[model samples]
Target: MLTIKSVSKSFDNLSVLDTIDLHVKKEEFVSIIGPSGCGKSTLLEIVTGLIAPSNGEIYFNEENVTGTTNKLGYMPQKDVLFPWRTVLENVIIPQEIMGIRKKDAEKKARQLVEKFGLSGFEEYYPSALSGGMKQRANFLRTVLTDKRLLALDEPFGKLDALTKREMLKWLTTVRMETKQSFLLITHDIDEAIFLSDRIYVMSSRPGRIVKEVHVKEKHPRSNGFLLSKSFSELKNELLSSLGV
Candidate 1:
């Protein structure tokens, strides 16, 4: 559903990404993991067209994507919810920006909130929700953009370990139920393995795809899969690739 070719970026001779090439097929989940400053977030910005690549091209669904499109949704590392807006209001912001009528947007947002397990909290403020709940609200808002493809930048980065695990399971359920495609940026190798169909390990600084590991697990994967022999093998392989 998306393709990036020979993408690179630099600022005043400091390279961030270098000749990066990757793709995500329809309804497929992909993750990129690497050490800090490896340009994972930079690559995501390029894909989202929030920033331009210094060189190379990006394509979405066979067409060259030069700028942001309504077909792809994004959630950055932070929830970035508006403290003043209630959960429902925050969710409908994208639709509002797209010029959908307030009533119609609210209806859609309400449905998404219920589907994403935040039904009762629709009236809650961002500050009142737990870290996991905030991210769920953020995910609902992102998906409510009517986009089938989502690019998430460490959506679970701020959660505690236990909450992160719960969120991962929640995300898995949502993906199975929605069949939406995702490209995620994460520093957690285990999270990547648990969520992605394919994993891209990047090199440092002038980031490049150092290796690609295919996670052969089926969808609706359980936390039990994390303890299996293959999971450990894959995790170790990824660590080795990242030079950790």
Candidate 2:
């Protein structure tokens, strides 16, 4: 449902991405894993029209959408929630920006808050929520934007290991229910392997697609799947690709 062809980005004399070619099929979860400063987030920014590529084109539903804004939803590395606003208020801000009536937006947000496990905490401030809860709230806000494809940049990077694992499990269920296409930028190979249908391994800056590994494991993957031989092999393969 999304395609990027021969995409390249440069700032003055420094090049960040080169000859990038990638796609995400409808409802497929794809991940880009690489070293820090490898321009993964920059590529996402280009895809979402926050920035323009020096060369190449982006397509959604086979239509040229390069340099277009609001083509998809974006959730950045940080939650960026307003401490002053309650959870429901934060979730509906996107609709408010799009001219949705306050009553209408709240009605929709309330439903999502319940679905996303934020029902009773709708009136709570960000400071009152745990790290995972805050991230879940942020995810709800992103989902309410009504976009088919969501660009996620290290959405769980700040969480502790246990929290991150729990969130990953929750995300798998989210994917199953929502069936929305995702393009994720992450440094965690295990996270990529566990959640992605396909993983793109990128080289260090002037980032290039060094490898594309398909995770053959089916969705609703049990945690036991993580301990299987197949999972170990995939992890080892990805580790080799990253030169770890």
In terms of lDDT, the poorest run of 10 residues in model 1 is 62-71
The total number of steric clashes, by the backbone 3 Å criterion, in model 1 comes to: 0
Error of 2 at 18 (Å): 0.6
Candidate 1, 140-215: lDDT as tens digits: 8888877889999999998999999999999999998889999999999999999999999999999999999999
Best by TM-score: 2
Candidate lDDT scores, in order, read 0.91, 0.93
Error of 2 at 64 (Å): 1.3
Residue 14 in model 1: shift from native, Å?
A: 0.4
TM-score per candidate: 0.97, 0.98
The C-alpha stretches of model 2 lying farther than 4 A from their native spots are none
Model 2 earns a TM-score of 0.98
